[model samples]
Target: MVTIDQANQDFAQKVQSMDGGETLMLCFQCGTCTASCPSGRLTAYKTRKLIRKAQLGLEDEVLSSPDLWMCTTCYSCMERCPRGVEIVDIITLLRNLAVEKGVMSAPHKKVGEMLVKFGATVPLNSEYEDKREALGLARKPANTLGDEKALADVKKILKATGFEDLVGGN
Candidate 1:
């Protein structure tokens, strides 16, 4: 049986393997992150639980948790962490790991595809265009769906980051 120290050491090693997860080990379990998280209050989300899972080397629990995806990148937890742990960065790392491990669903994968294809999560359909025009804004040019140069840059970054494989394609 593993001792508490041994378990903690193992968790530390696992967190260290992640790009931005090294800071997660510094958390003191003060519950500040959970109290500060906006999503935790609304949903069953709990940032503190995620930190505990990471601290215990509960890899499957951390990777497959919807709480990790619920974070809005709002940085509230990061700001509240007294140990200066990069809470948002840790969440992002968990999200990337989840996606890479195929724990995320097809709809989640499609969101990435949509972002790659349209440069936005929400497709700017004709109704949106009509609403923009009705609000007195000039109609965007037909070719203004997505900026070509920006899309190319995004594709290059995604390819370099192995995000294409994470989402299962371009």
Candidate 2:
């Protein structure tokens, strides 16, 4: 349980003001999000815990905790929420907030780098390329790896949006 001090007042309100976060106040701690979270079943992540932290204004804990990044954004929680809270969107918004504030973790940073480089979070390897070639498909699949212009465009977009700075990769 996180304790909020006067210094952290209105943290919940701040989060609610964010896009896709407006319905955050609708959550009544029903625990449905937790019950429905696939990540929670496999990891230490508790969707309800994150929401509770946000609702209670535990800004520092909520932003800094790695659990904030555990959500796969599959939308199962949002689908099951009784209040129609956009749980997935809220989680994604929170993650964006966390990253913008330099609260990202190392693994996530690596994936961001891969996205910037390969235009996909999961990059390709020789094994997959060989398999694709064996199947008579374009070995590099016309994506960033196979297309120079597209890769340069991805790099350009990442740079223009400051995502490279945010995730610490070029």
What lDDT would each prediction earn against the true structure?
A: 0.77, 0.85
User: For model 1, what is the alpha-carbon lDDT of residue 89?
Assistant: 82
* lDDT tens per residue, model 1, 107-139: 777888876676566777788779889999755
User: Where does candidate 1 have its weakest 10-residue lDDT segment?
Assistant: 1-10
Q: Estimated TM-score per prediction?
A: 0.75, 0.91
The residue ranges of model 2 lying beyond 4 angstroms of the native Cα positions read none
Candidate 1, residue 117: CA error in Å?
A: 3.0
What is residue 22's positional error in candidate 1, in angstroms?
2.1
Point out where model 1 deviates above 4 Å.
1-11, 105-107, 131-138, 141-165, 168-170
Q: Which tens-of-lDDT digit does each residue in 51-149 have in candidate 2? A: 888888887788898899888888889889999999888888888888768788788889998888788888889999999999999889787878889
